[model samples]
Target: MDLRLAVYHAAREGKLRLLQKLLGGRSAAERGEATSGAGAGVGPPLLIAARHGHRAVVDYLLEQCGARVGEGGPVSFDGETIEGAPPLWAASAAGHLPVVRTLLEHGACVNQTTRTNSTPLRAACFDGHLDVVRYLVGECGADLEVANRHGHTCLMIACYKGHADIARYLLARGADVGRRSLKGNTALHDCAESGSLEILKLLLDAQARMEKDGYGMTPLLAASVTGHTNIVEYLVEGALQQEEDEEEDEPAAEGKKDPSTAGLSSSSSSGQPQVYCTREAAVEALELLGATFVDKKRDLLGALKHWRRAMALRHQGGHDLAKPEPQQLVLAYDYSREVSSMEELDSLVTDPDEMRMQALLIRERILGPSHPDTSYYIRYRGAVYADSGNFERCINLWKYALEMQQGNLEPLSPMTASSFLSFAELFSYVLQDRSKGTLATQLGFSDLMGVLGKGVREVERALLHRKDPIADSVQFTKALAIILHLVFLLEKVECSPEQEHLKRQTIYRLLKCNPRGKNGFTPLHMAVDKETTTVGRYPVGKFPSLHVVNLLLECGADPDSRDYDNNTPLHVAARNNCPLVMSALMEAGAHMDATNAFKQTAYELLDEKFLPKAMMQPFNYVTLQCLAARALDRHKIPYKGFIPEELEAFIELH
Candidate 1:
């Protein structure tokens, strides 16, 4: 082994004497060679010991071997380690307070950063090392506002890792709550993505703005997309409360009028209701407030009052009089779509409908009904209606939009593709809920099949018309996978020979399309791409359609195919905590022992600390245990109670 490797091993293993012997009597040139391995370079012995929390080895390396405490060096031979990090950074990253103190006492810079501009304070915060973070900010005078290469502040990293205590300490120490990442996400956004409800509340109380990120996603929408139900509820409640508070303050600022002298008639001077001009506005207000009563009964009466006031403004032409510019109208429409998606997840229907209607009206007026932009808004409105359980209306709206673009747009246009996808998704939903008197039930199976077949042919024609259709395009592959997945779902129902032929053609197209798309994800990966949530397990039998996975498997997709990160389908399933997918992959003999590029087994990657919050879940703990049991069984190892008793009972019972 290289001398640096030998020294690194000795220090990491806490063999101080061995580390000293390796360094003693070595020439300066040899010492440099030992510290500098091939490529980046293995970190010095002191850094190795500090990173492993070997206090004695670190002390001996510094005090006895005369290792320079502040000396910066290249990365380790593994090529995965950080380059140009000082000993203090390693110690801080590992949460070795003693080693950190020793290095600092020996004149190490407290704020020294890595080549990525990641400071020791950020490392400590990222690891949830509260004591070390406090020491760095409070005693060592580390800059709280410093951001890493990704522009993540200590507070943001703390929230991102779900370290509530560290976040609190950092906030108390004056860490800026408004500091944003390179993506323009604040600490609150990090908390939302991480499902750190406690940290989210802390940031909210500290006045973190509920602003949109570069992707036009609010913190609430981010939480919803990640399926953090608790965070979603909290954010919604907070928004309602802020609106209430603002309403209350408005009267105070305007000075209260004498209610006794005010007109008490049902009609205003203009012969309209005092609160609203149109009956539609009144009905909408009641519906919006009434929808909340199902789950948010506590806010019902207050919300009703607030709605009346809002409607009064709208009735007085609040929307038309202060019409936003065309650009602002588009932005408003985008925000409405995000809110509509969140409401769909929450099963709340009223607010999204009202928002969508407002956006659609604005777009129709500004862009004209036949404009492609108006058609896009129409498609969005259809989605909102579908989410609201009005499948027939959703289908009609989408069909109208498609009709408007039939001659004006190219078959291969992105807008046309999106419309087809919308129809496919809505039709699939209708099929799934056929017993619920959905639109598909009204239309016979043959009629639905006709619509689906037409869509398939249009998509196929578009794909074939493209020059060099086989050329790799991530967007095309994703679109093709979605269409095929829908076709696979339709395959479960009985079909005529023509419909069956179309289905087979769709499947052939998907199979022929390049599976290796963006981030090296195969079509199978895109089919089940929902992020895992910390909230709870998805209800039984509600997993996204398994037909996609089944079709891919039957078509000879390698179960152990690795992505760019070398994560196989099993690894993806494990990280996403999709137990149903996990079962299917395991049944198909997926490689349970397959490891990622980081040498993490599928079981080991089960949404612990490293993955984004959206990918962490309490249910993943159970999945981890189950996967562990499966691994042991595969190896013919005995069940020796290595797992928790409850888990063992679950495995045995199942």
Candidate 2:
């Protein structure tokens, strides 16, 4: 390693003696010259030492070498890199109190923030470092109201993290309680959603109003959505008590309250219904809480309990809260209906299967299919079914989720790519399972073909707007490899004449899209390369696969198509030592004498160990025309104007 990087590493590891040994009493200018230029990769020496809580090393660098205290450099937290984080911000975020104190004592800016505008105090509050928070705020003059780019404040993070003492300190310091984030969520809403009942109480006592967020959710509903039963009950009970106190204090000049409005109050002054107020909010909270119990907790009995309470509340007044109805019955949900009456809801407990179906329906209805949790729970349920040996149900539910993601997410979205990759892994695992005749069902052609068609559609969508770059190459390549794996798996299925035609039509559509992966590899290059297996968590599919290669050629993949390296698929086949694939490509009219950029023909590129196998081919597939093209190119004969444009281009391939 470079001496500069070596010194930087020693400083980061907190070895003060080693750092001193390396510097050897050099002058400040010499030391600075030794550890210059952002420490190469690990930020400056002082930044890394402070980030890792190396107070001794930090002092040595600051007092001895005069390392800049306020200098900003790259720092990473929780696998995500936060660029340009100062020493104080790194020390504070890492919860190193002494290191933070040392940096602060050395004249570090207290209000210094990261590239994201997250402050030292905010970072300290995030991890519940009360001492660092106190030092920064009470002594160093750290600004409490300095929010990050997303407008999230220190009080909001403190409350959400359930740090009661820190939250109290911030409140005592007059951190604004009603401050809303970019998403319109206040500290009380965050506290409720994170299940911090104590913080919720603190915010409520601070007069935090019941307000709607960007999602139109109040604190009570936020509690319900996150399955915090204690917070829900508290918010509901408080709202009810406040409503009674208001009724007692109101003037009689307003006239007697209508007898019909029992559980709910009249509309507010804005003419908008005050549904977020009084019992109306409580009713909605219970309904959403029931859905949370069903999907998130997977507790059917608990869901039933919440639903019963909501139904009881609904029936207490002349006006019943309307439950939103699905416009059309979904076959995926087994056409389950939302139970409006208590009798219908009560009957669900007798049949567990029906109860589970009701849970899926209720969650989808309440949260909508667009929410990530809705689809995540769906996939989770399918995986549970797969573990219990119910493979058919698992496949059906996964198919539904893939369809939903395609409809909702952007084309070439990572979520959709993940779904496609999951299908590839599942199909590969099932096919390789020896007990398929007894333990698992037979693989079907449509099952693999359907996902391939969707994968092709994603590619086509990305291609439709040519002005925009294709989805980043990683996503594009993974999708391409998965589609090839699906094609490989389809051959394992016994298809009828009609099924075969449908399969070919899908393959044709994919070929016409002409999508390219990394290295500008066409489908043919990917089919012959061995790296295709590492696309997923599992070893998804084998490559240098003759079956997939044949399928590509049969579907009109060009045999002589050149990649970015100008190596045809036959060259890739040769590098993999795949004689059978090379023979097949040669049979499909691939030129054997076509030299790549390295000027090596496929036959010359063959591995020495594979020579015994290469000798078994019927004959060398190189032709007189190919040799003549190669000779003209090698000798630099000027044949461009004399030959046809197509033939002239062909000669350049050598």
Candidate 3:
């Protein structure tokens, strides 16, 4: 190994002699790089030693080598680096109690934080380091409520990670239980979501109140969504008992009612208002949980059981419980409805597929399409179909999800980009010859052409309102390559005049928008370049095709359009060794002797093997008009104001 890396290894392995030897006679830049932990993926020597519990190396570096005690560096734990973490935090998080004690003894601050403001106390609580936690909080005067930048306290982390003993210690140390994070999630919500029933009881015993998150999700609903049956059952029982207690404690005074129960109950035959209404919220939670079991867990029987319980609770005790209605009809679900009676819920057992569809419908209705889980389960169900060789059904569902993403998500969103990439990969798969035995349906012109048209529309929509994005963005380049491949696929299919016209019309729209990607490569430029073939994981399309090039030229693509390197389409074709495409561009009025930024012509850029087999020669390209333009430019003759604009532009092209 190199001496710089050897120093880090010695420090990490606690080899004080090797580290002492490597520490002497280093260059200024190398020493600076080591001390700052800013070298190529290596932390400081003291940080590495402290993280691995090398107390001798730590003491030597700090005392003998004068290493900075509070110097922050990148330290890793469990395969993820926490940038700007002090040595004390790293040692505490790793449970190296000896290193932790040494660092603190050397005057390392107990409340020092990472880049995200996660304190050392919070770090110790995260991994259940009880001794480190005790030292940091009990002896060193660490603040119990010093949360991270997201407002997550030490108590919250302990509860979420199921460290019940650590949580008890924090509770006794005056850690706040009701403090919420930036997303409005408390300790109760975290324990509920993680299914830590022991921690859940601890927080409940501490009187942690039930509250909704930023997405309006209660702790009960969060438990149901994660499919924690034990926690959900326990919380549901508690909710019922609490409702009973509140009802019994209600006063019997005339014309006076509890504030939460006023105007809540529906009228009965007795004309006396019933105030026991906690079952309404419980029924909704169970119904939503049933949807989770169906889509997230793939448990049809379990989903039916939860929905049956929800329906039973909805009707029992004469409460006014009802499932919410959809604001608009969903064509993807075939206009599904919630089953009103227990018989309807039981009838779902006969047809498992219908029950699956109902799960999707209920999730979308409750979560709404804007929420990520709504589209997630939709695409997930589609993928399941693709895995079972039912690709036609898969394509239909994926198309619905794709359109839904386009409508709801912002332009150029990753989810939308992923949907487009999925279509490209799917089209490439079913068109392969090996898929012929399993796929019953044929890949059609309409299927490929339809997505291509939508893809173009999505690009147009992005450009309609905002300024055009930089073409070098990764997302933009991926989109451009995918669009070019889609056009390449359209060439293999046989289309009538109108279909072909529509195809040309779609290409026309894209060309009119004049979008570029990755070093200003236009559609025509990408069609003739070889690098576009590596845009996807699988083989989507080969570039430099004569057919794709000719179609782009016929549909308003500029023949001599230049990229960012000042290389025109002919220049790109020459680099790719596409003789046919170069000839087509030359025939379409491309300048044969035009120079790029490298001052090399298309004929000069061609490889030597192709030079002997070249279709167009130097003698054929040389003309008196081109010679006159070059001579004028070489001798500095100025004729710009004297000539017409088009003639002057042509002279400059040389």
TM-scores of all candidate predictions against the true structure: 0.43, 0.86, 0.83
Q: Which regions of candidate 2 are displaced past 4 Å?
A: 27-29, 37-41, 70-84, 105-117, 141-151, 171-189, 204-219, 238-280, 432-436, 465-471, 595-604, 610-619, 637-643
Best by TM-score: 2
Ranking by lDDT: 2, 3, 1
For residues 166-250, could you state the per-residue lDDT of candidate 3 as single tens digits?
9999998888989999989999888888898888878877877778787677787778777888777776764455444445765
The TM-score of predicted model 3 comes to 0.83
lDDT against the true structure, per candidate, is 0.61, 0.80, 0.79
* Tens-digit lDDT string for candidate 2 (156-269): 999888899999999999999999999899998889878988887778678788888875667887788789999888766644554444457664454645422333532244
Count of clashing residue pairs in every prediction: 0, 0, 0
For model 3 the local lDDT of residue 590 reads: 79
Query: What stretches of model 3 exceed 4 Å from their correct place?
Result: 24-41, 70-75, 81-84, 105-119, 139-157, 169-184, 205-209, 241-278, 327-331, 433-442, 464-472, 535-537, 544-546, 570-572, 589-654
User: Candidate 2's error at 434, in angstroms?
Assistant: 7.2
Clashing residue pairs, backbone N/CA/C < 3 A, model 3: none
Give one digit per residue, the lDDT tens place, for model 1 in 1-654.
867788777876898777668877887666555544344346676777777789887777766666778666654423466887888998898888998998898889999999989899998988778889888888999998889888888888889899999999888988899987888888888898899889987886787776767655567656644446566555444223333333555554444432221222223335322321122222232333332332234343443343344344333311222223443333323333212122232342345444344435433543355456568757766776678776666666677677656555665467776776566555656667777765556544453454555554555555655654345344455454545445555654677788666555555554564445456766566554552111122111122346667766766656766777777777777766666676677667665555667766666666655444344332433456556655665677766568678666444322
